[model samples]
Target chain A: MQKNYWRSNLKILSILLSIWFIVSFGFGIIWSDSLDQLQIGGFKLGFWFAQQGSIYFFVILIFIYIYLMNRLDKKYKDKSEEKL
Target chain B: MDTQVLTYIFVGLSFALYIGIAIWSRASSTNEFYIAGKGVHPVANGMATAADWMSAASFISMAGLIAFLGKDGSVYLMGWTGGYVLLALLLAPYLRKFGQYTVPDFIGARYYSNAARLVAVICLIFVSFTYVAGQMRGVGIVFSRFLEVDINLGVIIGMCIVFFYAVLGGMKGITYTQVAQYCVLIFAYLVPAIFISILMTGNPIPQLGFGDTLVNSDVYLLDKLDKVTTELGFNAYTENTKSTIDIFCITAALMFGTAGLPHVIVRFFTVPRVSDARKSAGYALIFIAILYSTAPAVSAFARMNFIDSVQEVQYKEAPSWFKNWENIGLIAWKDKNNDELIQYSSGNALEGVKPDFNNGRGLSGERLVNNNSDLSNSNEVYIDRDIMVLANPEIAQLPGWVVALVAAGALAAALSTAAGLLLVISASISHDLLKKTFMTQITEKQELFYARCSAAVAIFIAGLFGIYPPGFVAQVVAFAFGLAAATIFPALLMGIFYKRLNKEGAIAGMLSGLVITSAYIINYKFINVHLNSADNWFLGISPEGFGFIGMIVNFFVAFSICYFFKKPPKSVDQMVDSIRNP
Candidate 1:
């Protein structure tokens, strides 16, 4: 049961980190040159991510995590209480 | 008709209003002092929070900072605003639920240790002081600019005003004053932007003014700004010339830092209910977005105006505003050649408000060139960027009443935040330092007395910082955000959600994070300053981003220690369950 939580936490962490990396580090920094080639309403894709897009993502990520954490807390809560 | 008399009248009137409010709503009990009696309306709390969070830096320097750094300055806009998200979703609600008087109180209880609270207090003081120093400087700057007073004298005058209201009502005083400030500053901020926007884009709303195509021009506002600046050997205003890593890290750090700031978090605690706290966060951001969104437009408009009006002009034939700003000492023009076509002034461009020109010739009959002039040349044109916002009205030739209102608004921004910061300092000394650590059984009256003294001391120290600011107002503020990011942010997040994380691990994590993060910033800012326009910052990660590194280290160190240490008290899981259940 402990191992299951550990596994789930790792999975969530990996998914979160990947999103963070892709938006900020990948599109914003690493793949910036390629992104600059593409424009969003006259703003380069890379530049947009750097300035505005990632902030929006950050807001989304926190909400997702908050919602997920609340659910996780519920799932891992005392089964004895439910049975009673 | 003197500007000084007008300034004194408006400032004095505003001061009278704040003092009167303090007398009416002065905190009668500790709870009232610390959390505005936990009865603030959501929108009211939000307005106060906006005022508290948007300090002198936001009021005076943010747009100018953005104007100069071009696209790279998004780090501040994104970082500061992004922190609100972190605050809303992660930190604010839980902290409010935690039901603590101060951040250190939460840390102390969660860790079940006084040592942890002490560390938290230390970091809070360090961070808040760094921030307060910037506010002090901003106060001095505004005073010197508008009232034609010396910087030191201006700071002292500011100190007395802050001491007046902040000394009375604590959080209650600040909250009410901040609401009033929000009105004045926002009006001051927007009225000019609206005028400028309408002039440039035929759009009255500053937010829309930014992206709209320029009037009688083919290009968007930002694009035009980009072209003009780039042509004048400045970075293209809309271009992302910073490394992605820096932007990411800095923005992340600021987000967490905002969430961690005890003063800002404490604002949410003023509301009565959990639902109120959550609702307040949304409303606070909405109020802030009014200024935040409008700011970028103002910055763009200002930059476009700056370049359009002043680029490639002969010394003699420079525009009237240039000579005006030069007389105050913001911009200088000089030719090495003994040509009569040059103008040069320095120290402060806006000092005298009108360049006398002394008949358009240097005393030596040689033109000053490239901003070099004598030390005594108080007449030299040296405009501080912080002046950009306050001076925006006059620079764009707005009405005198609008300019007067802007002055009032500038004071509102500075004073509201000052009151908030002073409240925190008072609480730390009164509640944490005196009541908890020293005199454990002190009476309420004695505690209040000590609190007042500590506030006086803190104001004095803050006054000193204002008189002689160590750095630009915004950079000093970053230290506050950085310290909070490093210390409280990680611990609070872990404590609320991770039941297994114990006191020992939290202390270690917070201390290590504080030490490491501050060391990085200190090393960069003071010990080893190198780079062009701070462009050589790591991963292009400026000092603003350094705290994110510290936060990660804190989390890892904390988790690692947790793995080795015992689990938190059995009660922690139950508490977490209760919070999550709701």
Candidate 2:
């Protein structure tokens, strides 16, 4: 049961971290010029990600992680109590 | 009221607030001194962390840096903030669960070796000192400029204010004071940004104003900026001049380095639960994002306004800010073509990094600098990038009080970070070096006494660095992040996630990372600066980005060594499991 809980935590972390990379490194840096061809309002999509979008996404990602981990902690706590 | 009087009032009130908070929250125990009794609320801790992390560089210089570097400056924006994500996910929660007074304490216990702890302490001291020196210099600059005091006197005054709170209240005092500082600095940063955004683009929100069209016109701010910059022989403001690989590596290095910063990580230990650590990181980023997102906008506005104000304007007709900054030796104008008009183009206007002023005024009453004018370009002006934020309010003709608020805010930013760094240095010395390593019989009261004494000593040394700042101060600030990324981050990350990493592997990894990163930075940045070009950099990665390569090497060396060594003992494995659980 503990192994399952740890596995779940790892899974959540990988998913969130991948999204973080895609926004900041992928859209912002690696493919920034390519994405610059597309504009959102006055900002090129790539520049927005670099200057503004990625920071906002980072905030949201952390909050989501907090919510998910809290739920996971509760789930494991109840299961261990039942076993006891 | 005059700007100086208002500046005095704002600065005086803020100092009074910090000292008052210090006296009220004086730490009685070592726990409170080191980690605020482990009782700070998540949101308040988050605010303190934000203030501690921002520093004077973030508050005053980052926007100016971005203004000059153009799109290439994204490395700092993404690198600094992205590390918080890594910290929240990989390091902070685990470290808080480990529950130690200092980072070295965790290193010692986890590796079961005093040698590992000592190495960690050395790295922490090196990184913290390199960083704190910059903060002290920032305080001196703000005070010398606004309060009209000598720069050395400014450093001394800053030391006393920090010494009062840091030596007495310790972390408990610092945490609350930083919470107040975050409020002051963020407000100071935003007010000017908003005013400039409205003046330039008819948009009050600077973030959106950056993208919006200019007032009474259809041209987007960035589009106009790009056109103007390229026309002046500069790189397009929206385009990257740096190589893509260099940008990628630098950003990665900074991200990992920020996650590894000891002062920032220690803030998580002030919170109550593992969950609060994660939540506090989120809140801290939210607070940080308020300034980070607005910074690019300020950069764009400052660049546009600067160009519009000075380019091709006759020196006799130049604005007061031009001559004011000139008298302070930050900006200079030379009649290069004998035209007497400021032909602000690209390339160096003067022969060196800064202008060496002569004794007399120029033909147009501008400060006469002795540096030979570069004939390569028609540029007649030499403007320091550090002045972009400091001179922004005057350039835009903001109210006197707004200018005063910025001075107070810059001091808050510098002092908060300096106090945080001093606390980390003192704690590592008192707790890790003395109590744990040598004087193991010391009582808690004695440990607390040592902590205060060490903090006072650290502040004095930091003040000296500010007064007699080394020529390499700016270059070495980046080295702090590189060393931290290469050494501390890998050690702590591996200690938590890779349970098989033994003392031999961790120590070997840290030492290798430290040696390689330092050698590369010193070779290129300090010792052989003339050859510090793209052609000579390994893998085309500059010294600023070599830490990423060092980190990779650290991981590889540790894993290989761990394969040969026996696994960590059973009890250590159980301890790792416990931390992983909650």
Quantify all predictions' global Cα lDDT against the true fold: 0.74, 0.93
Q: TM-score for every candidate vs. truth?
A: 0.85, 0.99
Please give, as one word, the docking class of candidate 1.
incorrect
Model 2 off-target regions past 4 Å?
none
Candidate 1 wrongly placed segments (more than 4 Å): A1-84, B1-6, B314-330, B336-383, B471-475, B531-540
lDDT by residue (tens digit), candidate 2, B1-582: 999999999999999999999999999999999999999999999999999999999998999999999899999999999999999999999999998899998888889899999999999999999999889878977888888889999999899999999999999999999999999999999999999999999999999999999999999999999999999999999889989999999999999999999999999999999999999999999999999999999999999999999988999999887888787788888899888899888999989848999798878878888899888888888988888998999889999999999999999999999999999999999999999999999999999999999999999999999999877888997799999999999999999989999999999999999999999999999899999999999989999999998899999998888778888888889989988989
Candidate 2 clash pair list? none
Interface RMSD for each of the candidates:
4.6, 0.6
All models, RMSD in angstroms = 5.5, 0.8
The local lDDT score (0 to 100) that residue B231 gets in candidate 1 is: 60
